[model samples]
Target: MTIITRFAPSPNGSLHLGHALSAIVAHDRAKADGGRFLLRIEDIDGGRSRPELAAEFRADLAWLGLEWEEVRAQSTRIAHYDAAAEELKAQGLLYPCDCTRAQILAADPVIGPEGPIYPGTCREKHIDPHNCDGPVAWRLDVAQANRKTGPLIWEDELAGPQTARPEMLGDVVLLRKDPDTPASYHLAATLDDAADGINMVTRGMDLFSATHVHRLLQALLGLPVPRWHHHSLLLDEQGRKLAKRRHSPSLADRRLAGEDGRALAAALRAGQLPTGISCSK
Candidate 1:
């Protein structure tokens, strides 16, 4: 199969250095293999997503001399996500979850790879597909879903072969209360990869655990599987992962300051740390 990869970024904030690393890696990998690279705007978060930032993201990639064969936005594909969610719900593999972050934190559940594992407070609550009282998020029944899919495995280019362990993350929220974007990152991304014919997924190592759950989703939804390459994440001077919440230095800022975006991309490709930036282990 022809190698295909994508650099998906949320337009909630400016494109930071960490974002550049991921984009450059994915872009170059596709070019090196003479394959297709796609740019996807993960702007499904209704409140956080800034549509204007999507244009800035495109400019940033162009400044870095990276080009993509196609571009798409998650906000444009709500029906596909709803269709997938409906399929899982029909099979009784999903339940309406009204749990809030504060409530889950207060419950003091086991700290898993992705922070506090959801306590499954609303696991038993069933919502009528035709009539729903109020807004509620959709959570996957991992245990039930797993029983049907049986043992599962997916290969990561960097981490090698791995068994599916979706249970570690607990019942993940696949859909949210946002009517405009009912799909969560887990559900949308898994489906998008298959829909885009992405045979290989290149992303940060931080999302490694997510692949396990995604594998299960693919199996349950009958989506095509893709190999993964979870690369190291860019870290700050404090050894913490670079995050948009922290206002990490953005590519736009650097570009405005007359920095050479191509040079920076080359340095990242060569594994050379730029100034205080470090690769997370």
Candidate 2:
């Protein structure tokens, strides 16, 4: 089968050094493997997702010399995500979670296969998570999903190997539960990957647990399981991760100050080089 990868970044903030690394890694991974790469705008939260921001992200990626088979914007496909969430709900593999964040914290559940795992606090509430009018967070049926999903173990081409126990991956929130949008990261991500025919996923090691949750979602949704590679993150000189919120030296700022895309790409590569990437640092 042909390999396909995605470089999906939320447009909540500017794409910085970390994003450059991920985009280069993802784009080059597919190109090197004789595969296809896709650029996806993971702007699920319309409340935070902005057209200008998405435009900037695309421009930044292009500036860095990253390319894709096709570019997709998540906000444009809410209807499809809505349909998939309905299907999952009908499968009884998803449930409505009425418990508030504070309530869940009061419960202080164990950290499951996924980080900050949330057990089904309202599992018995039987409340309809989707009111169809407003927004609320929705969660997947983890315990029920476990029955269908087995030991979740996979090898990371970059980060070695890893596993996420079903018991460890507690029920994950599917929608923001009456969220302003239809699906959450976990839901939209899975649906988008399957619909786009992505067969391989390359991203930062920070999302390793998320890949596990995505694995469970794939099982529950019956989507194809793709090979995953979690590459190391690019760190700032302070040893902290480069992020959009830093505001100190945003990629946009650097670029505006004459740090062209090539220069920015070189700077990121100089920090943490990905294997097989022939860049002028």
Q: Report the Cα RMSD per candidate.
A: 1.5, 4.3
Query: Could you say which candidate leads in lDDT?
Result: 1
**lDDT per residue as tens, model 2, 132-220:** 43445667776677777767766677666777554555777777754466677778888898888888788777677778778877777
lDDT by residue (24-61, candidate 1, tens digit) is 88888788889998998888887888989988998999
Q: Poorest 10 consecutive residues of model 1 by lDDT?
A: 125-134
Badly placed stretches (over 4 Å) of model 1 are 127-133
What lDDT, from 0 to 1, does candidate 2 have?
0.72
lDDT of each: 0.90, 0.72
